[model samples]
Target: MPKVDAETIVHSIAAETNTPEETVARIYADALDTYRADARVLDYVPLFAARKVRATLRQNSAKPH
Candidate 1:
């Protein structure tokens, strides 16, 4: 199987959370920005960012109005 990348993560989470792709992409970019600000390690940055975005989406989904 082909390896998954950040784009794939964003799309997957967007679909799973029933969010717009643009919104998910924006969120992913924001997550990357946060990591970059901290000078996070290079190799695992994408994975970490994806995990962060996924958690954010999950948390948002779980919140009640």
Candidate 2:
């Protein structure tokens, strides 16, 4: 797999989810940290982190304000 760039991921996620880049960046960082903690294979960390952050943003949006 090609190397993933965090900035690209952050921008893509922010655009797709209609979220702010700053917010996405913060969440992506946290998600990356969480996944990195127990990841045995480092190659998929960015993919996993991006998925997790996207899911989290979606879930949060679904919740009642």
Models, CA RMSD each: 2.6, 0.7
For residues 1-65, what per-residue lDDT tens digits would candidate 2 score against the true structure?
A: 89899999999999999999999999999999999999899999999999999999999999999
TM-score of each: 0.79, 0.94
Q: Which is the leading candidate under TM-score? A: 2
lDDT of each: 0.83, 0.96
> Which ranges in model 2 have alpha carbons more than 4 Å from their true place?
none
Clashes of each: 0, 0
For model 2, give the RMSD to the true fold. Answer: 0.7
Model 1: runs farther than 4 Å from truth?
1-4
Residue 19, candidate 1: how far off, in angstroms?
Answer: 1.1
lDDT of 1 by residue, 1-65 (tens): 34548778888888888999999999999988888788745666677788898899889889997
